[model samples]
Target: MRIWSQCVKELAQFLRDRLTVALAFILPLLTLFIFGFAIRLEAKNIPVAVQDFDNSPLSRSYIERLYATNQLQSSRWDGIGSPQAALDQGIAKAAVIIPPEFSRRIKAGETSPVQVLVDGTDVNNARVIRSSIEATTRFFVRNSQLQTNPSLIQVRSRIWFNPGRQESLYIVPGTCAVILWIYPSLLSSIAMVREKEQGTIIQVYASSLSAEELILGKGLAYLIVGLGIAAVVISISVIIFGLRFAGDPTPFLISTPIFVASATMFGLMVGTRVPNVTTAVQAVATTGFLTALLLSGFIYPLSNIPFPLSLISNIIPTRYFIPIIRDGFVRGTGWLGVWFYLLMLMLLCLLLFNIARRNLSRMQLPD
Candidate 1:
């Protein structure tokens, strides 16, 4: 009954703390809006250089088709230099090289390979541009040969995992990871800070509640609160925002505790060191936002980052959780695909929780 009373009192106090309430409610919406605009895979307004060596109608029509896709916005060639110069100068993502005898080669039923020099700097974008170019060229070739052969093969392409490429689906899962990164800190930090600020932590310091019990109690309190917020966000993401949840909820259910535990311990560590509320908020915000945007596979894919940076990111809990969440939701991957990440998260949580408890137990208060 005493523990129940203490829990209820803490809940009420949590409700009354304006900063806590604001963080718990208002901040998630703000994140949703910011990230909704940032995570995009489809490229628009890509620049290219066209080298029309043949000076034929076929070449002109192909160039017009590239423009018609509405993907590349601007294209140019000085006609004084090779397409390689354009690519080297970063003036073009791709250059279309048409051979001088392209028309004659096609008429004679000879395959004259039209070289497409694509900038492979961004593998995904390069693939998109190259695919579009080849697709257009293939269509022209097929139609031209149809009169001679009388039979043409039709081609169809099926896109998996975000067929429409709606930014919402990608951003929502990333947003969930970002929220987990910051909210756990906000939840755990405030509770401990309030105790320190209000002169109540001293009672626990002098009592028989042991360092582990106090840490567990505080962590459990924040976990329940954090999960409530997570549930609200998930409901909003799925039902209100129309983001799909393709995989079993069990993965999320299994992994969230581990994520929250790591985040909570990290927050407790920060809370123990900070002197005021503003700094606490700032510490969590800076660490959380940077970790989510840079270290986690949210704004950039892990493979795209350099080798050393990628290794550093592995230590970040979100680095593990984001892939699992994305895989579970977007790819509909089963537990087998995500168990490794889940294990990493659990191990990190255990390590952090132990460290936080040790630190909290060591914090000295007035006798």
Candidate 2:
């Protein structure tokens, strides 16, 4: 009964703070909008410069094939003397230099080398441009009279997951993990710290509530709020962005509460350590947000990160939850496949909640 009363008081306090209420409701949607629209992984319509010194039908044919792929767009650099000039002036991301002997070399069954110059400024864009140019050139050679060898090996490729390569398909599910990590911890940490800063915590301490009851009450309030925000953001992803859940939603349903519990308890731990709301918010932003952003495989894969840094990612609870969300939602994998991740999340919840309970119990109460 006392715990229920404390829970109600926490909810009332949370509802009364206009700033916390606004952030609790508004921040998650705003974050989803920013991540959905602003950040993009796939590059398209890369501008390319074609410098054909041959000026022959073969060179023109090659240039036409590049445009047909729809990945590269030819840019006219009139009076730009050379392809290098176009590249130097930022007129094109890539340049194709066809030698005067291109057709003759091909007709004579000799090796013909075409120089492709790519701007290395943006590594990802440059890699895509190089691959597209190579694929297009290979396709042209296979179809043209230049291919005389009957024994030459040919390769066929197909992409499995995210076949259309839509960036949103990869990004939206990850955004859910990022959003859950930020808001739950931030809101709960600020809520607890606000009570400390305003001296309201003394009243609660004097009300004969046990430390465990106090922690559970505060955590329950934010857990409900966090879950509600998650539903809104997820609905937006499905309705607005068309995010699909391929796997059984059972694993996701089971894992989310565990993940949310860890986040809320983490915030409680932060709240107990910090002296004021400002410090708590900053702590959550720097520790929770940055750790989830960098270490959770949201922006970069954990396998790709080098040792020591990669070692740090192992402990981040968000790291475990991301795979659960991606596996259940994007890959449609069953519980057997995602059981490991769910287990990790459950263990983290237990650990964080235990630590938070202990910390809250030890906090010095005002007389």
- Tens digits of per-residue lDDT, candidate 2, 1-367, equal 7777777888898888798888987988999999988888767788898888888898889989999966899776774688889889999898999999988888789988999999999998999999999989888988785777755665678887667877787788888888998899988888888888888888777767777888888888888888998889889999988888886898998888888888998998899889998899899999899889899998787888888889888878999988888876678877988898888888888887888778777774644
lDDT, model 2, position 181: 82
All candidates' lDDT scores? 0.78, 0.85
Residue lDDT tens for model 1, 1-367: 4444455666788888887788786787677666765666778778888878888887677677777766774466576779889899888899878889987777677777788899999998999988878877767766555235645765678879878767677778888878876887777886778788988988888876666777776776677777777777777778755876687868878898778777887787788778777788888888766877788888788888897878888888988888877876788776978999999998888887788777887785534
Using TM-score as the measure, the top candidate is 2
Q: 295, model 1: CA deviation in Å?
A: 2.5
Window of ten residues with lowest summed lDDT in model 2 = 145-154
- Number of clashes found in candidate 2: 2
